[model samples]
Target: MSLNRRCSRTACGRPAVSTLTYVYADQTAVLGPLATFAEPHAYDLCEVHSERLSAPRGWDVLRLAPDPNAIGPTTDDLLALADAVREAARPVPVTVSAPSAETGREVARKGHLRMLTSE
Candidate 1:
């Protein structure tokens, strides 16, 4: 393996984005991201490195992505995860009933929520 844990695949340098945690019954393997070389970047282990990843106690792991070089949980990582959650939670389009007598008042009172749930 390369000293930097870079992707073993030639002509590609994308860093591993996430670890492929494999669980087979009781065995598991944690594959680490190998590398990615550009923006919107995610590095992942090459097939070779991925195959080599061995989980102690026979756990099977597949692969991870982004930068495997990234070590330790930091505040930034937590914030990033939170941002991802927020992005995923973004509302999709929903059908709304026409304003009823009370509905107009409800909408007026819940304008903020309406905006939040808007498509």
Candidate 2:
């Protein structure tokens, strides 16, 4: 499901790592992280193009730096992912919940566990 987007600049085939859009009224060029989806008014730029991006005379170019902490998966994230996989791989019990006349349908599903918090 990954998007294989290329730089919008002509003849530059590098992979897009940032998105650029202009604010016509304000005369500003905004360069930010890669957009979730391609926008008609936005242009995709590569690392090189993004670094060398410049605005026209009297225009401002706003560059949004990516968060350093969000660059990669942390150790805790990896461990949590592993734990989730292990939990999902485990076998389920034979007990089945059914609605009975004495009581209404089960308020909550059984056997399915979601990792809501660390604890």
Candidate 3:
């Protein structure tokens, strides 16, 4: 399921692509790419609202660049996944022995795989 946030503008349901926050002290409106987590005081906005955003006539608007890390998974992620799959697929020899008469149970273990004792 997608956890994308929707625009905060009334009547608009588009997914948020940026975040809007005001710096009251500096009289500045900060517009940047959507944050990793939603902030209680910040407003999440869609592409259109973000592009059309404007601060008060005398206030400054600070636009920050999109975060590169939030774009998506990188090559490293795929490489690590591939390595894990390869290691899991690599076969390992397993040794089996007859059940002990005293215990009357059989158990086997190989790598991370385990077999429960059967009476």
Q: Write the per-residue lDDT of candidate 2 for residues 34-86, one digit (tens) a residue.
A: 87789998999999999999999999999998766675667998999999999
Tens digit of per-residue lDDT, candidate 3, span 41-110: 9999998999999888899999998756655656998899899999999889775656756544446668
By lDDT, highest first, what's the ranking? 3, 2, 1
Candidate 1 has a TM-score of 0.24
Weakest ten-residue segment in model 1 by summed lDDT:
103-112
Query: Clashes in model 2: which pairs?
Result: none
TM-scores for every predicted model = 0.24, 0.55, 0.55
| CA error at residue 68 for candidate 2, angstroms | 3.3
Tens digits of per-residue lDDT for model 1, 9-109: 46757443333544456565555543323223333555554555555654455544545455655789799989999999987654454454532322222
Clashes of each: 33, 0, 0
Residue 26 in model 1: lDDT: 55
Model 3: residues with Cα > 4 Å off, grouped in runs:
1-3, 69-119
lDDT value, candidate 3, whole model = 0.83
Q: Lowest summed lDDT over 10 consecutive residues: which window, candidate 2?
A: 110-119
User: Model 2, which residues run further than 4 Å from truth?
Assistant: 71-119
Q: In order, what lDDT does every prediction score?
A: 0.49, 0.82, 0.83
